[model samples]
Target: MFKKLKITCDEATTICDKNQYGEATLLEKIKLNIHFIRCKICFKYTKQNMTLTKIYKGHAKSCKELKHCLSDTDKEVLKEKLNSFKV
Candidate 1:
């Protein structure tokens, strides 16, 4: 039945996120695609999510080659901030 394949926008988005992370099952992805057929908003969200993931992955590859660290003053400031947050 068509009802078996139907998914809400919220479910579509969750599946989209899981698909991005390679955590969605084949059935979920299929349902997501089915949902996208009639829902342009969910389709756009999936497109944007894929774009952001691609951009982050590209940035991550380049970032690993470079070393980044805070200076002693910055570290002390961060430590003070964390210490203040402690109950």
Candidate 2:
């Protein structure tokens, strides 16, 4: 019963990721929802994950119409940005 449903935060996070990609089973979803009952932090994490996925899906659809590669100038700018980020 309760013992079967009980999951650690790590397992909960994994299940949450699986759920994002539609890989989680119905039982896993049930267990995760049960986990949310007592764990606010994991619940918050799932909410944030869902939000990010939603945003990414919308952005990806728009990006499909855009170019697939950067130009020489664009590559140079990106290289400069990366070099600036390095110590």
lDDT of 2: 0.94
Which residues of candidate 2, in runs, are more than 4 Å off? 67-87
What would the C-alpha RMSD of candidate 1 be, to one decimal place?
5.6
What lDDT does the true structure give each of the candidates? 0.94, 0.94
List model 2 lDDT by residue over 1-87, tens digit each.
789999999999999999999999999999999999999999999999999999999998999978788899999999999999995
Displacement of residue 57 (Cα, Å) in model 1 is 0.9
Q: Against the correct fold, how does model 1 do in TM-score?
A: 0.67
The digit string of per-residue lDDT tens for model 1 on 1-87 reads 889989999999999998998999999989999998899999999999999999999999999989988899999999999999995
lDDT of 1 at 30: 92
| Cα error of candidate 2 at position 1, Å | 3.8
